[model samples]
Target: MMILALLGVLALAVGGCVCVVWAERGGPRWVRVVATITLAAGKVVQYSAKNRRRGLGGSNSADD
Candidate 1:
């Protein structure tokens, strides 16, 4: 089950990449929408990882 879930995630990532490329070439409206969603998701994941790393440093304050 875990393997299947991982595969699903991989597929989605690949599809999003494809959509981004297609949107760059002005493929279609749906492609642009998908690309936007994909980019937003990537930003969210990046910020989440940064926050997790900061939390791991044992500092709750953002001054660090």
Candidate 2:
């Protein structure tokens, strides 16, 4: 349990550090936007690598 808690905290800290690093760097707006997108899409990259995950299946149902 203690090890799991430590890992979770470590993950949170690392993620926060990444965000800080991303925000601090100076670059063009497009570069920043691309960086943000890349950072966000990183998690989904595993699915792409496996080529098993799918998309939303044409379900554009967004209730605002």
RMSD list, candidates in order: 3.5, 9.6
| Candidate 2 lDDT over residue span 6-28, tens digit each | 99978865765566466668755
Which ranges in model 2 have alpha carbons more than 4 Å from their true place?
A: 26-64
Residue 59 CA displacement from its true place in model 1, Å: 4.9
**lDDT at position 12, candidate 2:** 64
Q: How well does each candidate superpose onto the true structure, as a TM-score?
A: 0.87, 0.38
- Model 1 lDDT per residue over 1-64, tens place: 9999999999999999999999999979999999999999999999999989888776746456
Cα RMSD, model 1: 3.5
Residue pairs in candidate 2 whose N, alpha carbon or C atoms collide under 3 angstroms: none
Q: Compare the candidates by TM-score and give the number of the best one.
A: 1
